[model samples]
Target: MTGGPRTEPIDARAVLGRCRDAVAPALRAAVARLDPASREQATYHLGWTELDGRPGAGGGKAVRPALALISAAAAGAPIAAGLPGAVAVELVHNFSLLHDDLMDGDTERRHRRTVWAQWGAAAAILTGDALLALAHEVLLEAGSPDAAEAARLLAATVRELIRGQAEDVAFEQRDDVTVSECLAMAAGKTGSLLATSAAVGSILAGGPAGLTAALHGYGAELGMAFQLVDDLLGIWGDPAVTGKPVLSDLRSRKMSLPVTYAVHHGGAAGRELARWLAAPGPAGEVTDEPQLRRIAALVEDGGGRDWAAAEARRRMALAEKALAGAELPDRPRAELVALGRYLVDREF
Candidate 1:
């Protein structure tokens, strides 16, 4: 239970269970309308159907949609009003996953074939594009003011996302990356969309302006915390639980927090890591592993993981502070806090 909720945490599990239950059906119905042929293929890849087209596994954790609904209730908005917005966020989230798999040359996600692996890169790209379009279309049903705000958020978030991706790719070729720069890149790539989700959810819920502002602040902090945790998991988490190869981030020369720290704290190991990451190579391929593992060890020795965990905890505190300022009702607020805690503690 190390990466799960504590049983003595005052029914946090029960609260999150209720929120998850409420969100899942709406997410399913939203996905049910894709053209049968394409839908079947996507579903197959998602492990919702067998390779032979029989019923199969459950889909992803559905966290983004759940956040939207949970935030809506916390803001005193009708949960129904947030459904379209939730669906929009989910569509956008999945679209990012599809494209990310291709960019990282990953073969699998959620223990199933990635869109690129199952359908080829061109098909995956097209499918992701289609999802992006559908995400926008879904936002149109979010009501006038909500739709307009969500659309604005979507546009700005995409810009930041692309900028972050560019920075991430650029980090591979440069030895000058600082910890601050890496955090900025992380914010643009990972935090922007999450911040938008909370902000849009509040808008849809008809929350007071102050409450909506507080929710956006909460999401930004939580998003930062989430990515920091992800960086830690990428390097040190059990492969079976994380569903990815160990030290995969180092192998790919990605500029995550650990790598940034190692770069700053120059030494034999840091130099070795810098040397490997700066190796001139084709984009989007894993480089040397022996050297990468050595660097990962150095990172651990240098307290990079500890530093990152502390930072994540700090951000979590900030998020909670923002939530408190939002002044949500007790039941819904408790659920939201539980959900946030669960996100921070997730193993996969």
Candidate 2:
């Protein structure tokens, strides 16, 4: 779909960079309360310090915090008004990542060793717990007029995030995963936090209820689209750009969207895939390269990749619609729309 009129193109990278710059100081201060050991681990995980406590330059895309700040701006408040909520969502995101690395047995993230891999699972788990607690602490201490309400909202979102993650882990063992179930899991695991990021921003800004709801809807759709793209990348993304091994999801036997679709809707190819998945082997040992290539080809032949791409586009359209409906100024709304497009449009 064609976006709104534009004088110049919206630069999503620049916007995200600004958000990172604004939130980094607050994030560092919040995590500083931990003991030196925990602090070092946490900082390292955040891409601010090396494993040996030296400076480093690796980190996530900072998308959630940018969503928070932009949502606040859409609600007619200055971006700084959402700093507390931005920091809160970002901390929660990283906390989930730390634990996820342990749970998924993933060794690398953003081209660096995972916290669990670097310092042992115990250190990773404790530092993650510290970050989760610090997220709330930062919110409460932000002195926002609606801090109490924002905290309550964030608490509920955390519960949803846990529930989603639990479902994801459980799905790995079951063979009967459905597309609908996978969508629900995505909502819980990914959508909930994103929706909360937008909602918390609007709440902190004291934006109108309708506008808050619209932003929440925007975030939910964006989160689903984001996860769908991630699923696609897991199979076909360039290793150099994505910083993950090729066919990483298939190797791990994850029930991601494309795999689920292929398994359920791919007819003969689908059955072959099921058989391969059921083949007994050592845990976490993916099929060899030749077999893995066959699996990837089977998935593509089954229409799984095309289906997921279509769904991503559909969700992104809904996200843009939600942003357009919000009672935001023209420029911020356009930027938000541009951000939604960029999210689903990325290759890595």
Candidate 3:
């Protein structure tokens, strides 16, 4: 799927499905704790129910929850032992998605109207708040020996995620954003949560500190690799596969990894890219396909594309290296490594 799996690939769908099936009931019960209105919106957001409130299709790839369950297995525990971590991470993921949709003015997601688009921004905000609170509740109420420490970790991760989102918003107004700064934002926004996902199950399983730490390292590096590929797709992916138009990130002038590299590092073409980006975009977003293609070409010509692709592979290697010292069973370890490779090479 991606560049190529470094190890024989596990079926991504099956792994995700195993985790999703294990976590779904508990996740539903947790969402049921919210007020009726919030619960309704949350259910819809999760894709468990349609807008009219009937049973609907399933949700996302469940990647964070899968990592949570798999980490438990790596720690020599039953996957069910990871339920709290799995449910908490899934709630947190949806919480971020709810808030992000509104903040980014996104109207559609997964081929449906977003929470804010269908129910108003206030409703979206409230629903997101409820989900974030419920994430903590799930961890605190899990009653495991490590519940306290896991909750604390989740708290820290949430703070970093919010800080990253804040930085992303702040970047829109400034032109001097450095590549390092953008990377820092990405670590907080994306890496922190994935790190928590990979480590929290080990915590719940009462695994050794060294094992937990190693898992966190793997997740953190993999998160960076995943984000780089996502940025590439935001610019060049087929809309049919990606479920978004090509150059989506470029049009919004998002300071993605590649764009930032191109802006600061590409000599002449980079300078030209800067000028084009600085020009007031049509309605604050470049809509013309011809112009969008030109901007994408400039990003490639300026070396952003090549640099991002290389960095993604580098990060994936780092992810595998992070597990080198841990004495995990061959299968679980190989699966983790393969997941990172899949993210790097997937077209969408």
What are the clashing pairs of model 3?
Answer: 2-345, 3-345
lDDT of 2: 0.86
Candidate 2 lDDT by residue in tens digits, 1-348: 135435457888888788889888888888888888779888888899887767899588888898888878878899888999999999999999999999988898888899899889998899889888888988888787888988998989989999999999999889899999999999999999988887788888888989889889989998999999999999999888788788888888788899899999999998888888777867766958788889988888888899999999999888878766667777667777777788889773
Q: Put down candidate 1 lDDT per residue, 1-348, tens digits, no spaces.
A: 112222245455565455557766765665676766456655665456877677887666666666677668867777776777777777787777778889878887767777788778887787777677777777776665767777777778878888888888787667898999999998988788777777777777777888778778878888899999999988877888787787777667677897787767746666766676677867665656776577788777766777888888899888878877666766566666676778788662
Model 3 — TM-score against the truth? Answer: 0.96
Looking at candidate 3, the ten consecutive residues that score lowest on lDDT are 1-10
Please report, as a residue range, the 10-residue window in candidate 2 with the lowest summed lDDT: 1-10
Top lDDT: which candidate number? 3
Per-model TM values vs. the true structure: 0.87, 0.96, 0.96
List residue ranges in candidate 2 displaced over 4 A. Answer: 1-8
Model 3 per-residue lDDT tens digits across residues 102-171: 9999999988889999999999999999999999999988888999999999999999999999999999
Q: What local lDDT does model 1 show for residue 246?
A: 78
